[model samples]
Target: MTERVEVRQNVLKENDRIAGELRRGLAERATLCLNLISSPGAGKTSILEGTLEALGGTPLRVAVLTGDIQTERDADRLKRYGFPALQITTGGTCHLDASMVQRAMASLPSPDLDLLLVENVGNLVCPASYDLGEDAKVVVLSVTEGDDKPLKYPGIFRRARLMLLHKIDLLPHTRFSRDAAVADARRVNPEIEVLETSCVSEPGLGAFVRWIEQRLAEKRQAGRPARD
Candidate 1:
């Protein structure tokens, strides 16, 4: 048991060190990197896809790196949006480690991108334990999953600066309570910013786009040259 604990601690410490390096790289490039996390079927990809579509004429240059366990399907889907993209297949891994994201960064046509979205492999638990050198981490929870997800996955909720509540259009048909979910999330993370979204309805998409633009603007204001 002690040996196993030591191995785990070593792995975590190494990951955090690499993550810090990744963060420094992002800052040097002046890129707004977002680590997106959520459970499978939480509509994280859909939300990002929709934002990419909505922000087509926006001031920011957006790029995406999608992480999945096996297939390149998600990355392929986002490619149709006409932005730089890369797929990081994690084999059987549930989360995207700093090494995986670093490899993906090397693979993509991403140097000029103002905002980089690192769509983590769909898993709330393991992904929360890893950091991929991002400016911010966005935790996505679909209403269809259950309103208590923020309360259940407290670690992800607490670490995320933003919680995107997707699939809000299904609320009338489903039993999820928006108010209760927001309250639960705020209870865990008092400063968490929650944005409800529906890819189909496009109800709250403007707010999401505005948030991304704001982040990108902040990056531009920093005036740092891209790291080679």
Candidate 2:
């Protein structure tokens, strides 16, 4: 057990070192990177689709990189939306690491784009430990997934800067407790910005887009060359 623990620690340390480099590279190019994480069926892809549509023709130039255990389906879906999309099939890996993201970044349209949205492989546990050098980590939770998700997956909830409670259109049909979910998420992360969204009804989609724009603007401003 001790040896396993040490190995895991070493791997994470190396990943963190590489993530730091990736973060600096993104900053140099003034790209705002977002690491979006969630479990399977959490509506991550749907949320991305809606978000891309909302951001379309806006001032922010954005792209997406989606990860999966297998298949290019998600990437293909995003491409239809007319955004530059890349798919990282992790084979058997449960999560994406900094190294994978670094390679994907190279193939992506020049980091000149205002934003890069990374939809991490659909898993809650392993992905939480890997830092992809994103400006903000956003976790998506659908009401159907239950209100206890935050407590069950506190690590991701605690690490995330924002939480999107998706599937608001289905709220009327399900027994999921929106207030309980938000309360639990806040309990774990008091500073987390919570937003409700429904791709079907388009509720809160504008706010999500605005939030991304704000982050991109900040990253661009910070990356600007120091003027005398």
Using lDDT as the measure, the top candidate is 2
lDDT of 2 by residue, 91-162 (tens): 999999999998998898667777899999998888999999999999999888888899999999999999
Number of the predicted model whose TM-score against the real structure is largest = 2
lDDT of each: 0.86, 0.89
Off by over 4 Å in 2: 1-11, 202-204, 225-228
**Residues 1-228, candidate 1, lDDT per residue (tens digit)?**
355443335558878898888888888778899999999988888887887888777666788999999999998999988887788998999999998887778877657667899999999899988978898899988888989888899999999999888888888889999899899999999999998888888486777888888888887777656587
Worst ten in a row by lDDT for model 1: 1-10
Query: Candidate 2 overall Cα lDDT vs. reference?
Result: 0.89
TM-score of each: 0.90, 0.91
**Model 1 CA lDDT for position 64:** 94
Error at 190, model 1, angstroms: 0.7
User: Which regions of candidate 1 are displaced past 4 Å?
Assistant: 1-11, 202-204, 223-228
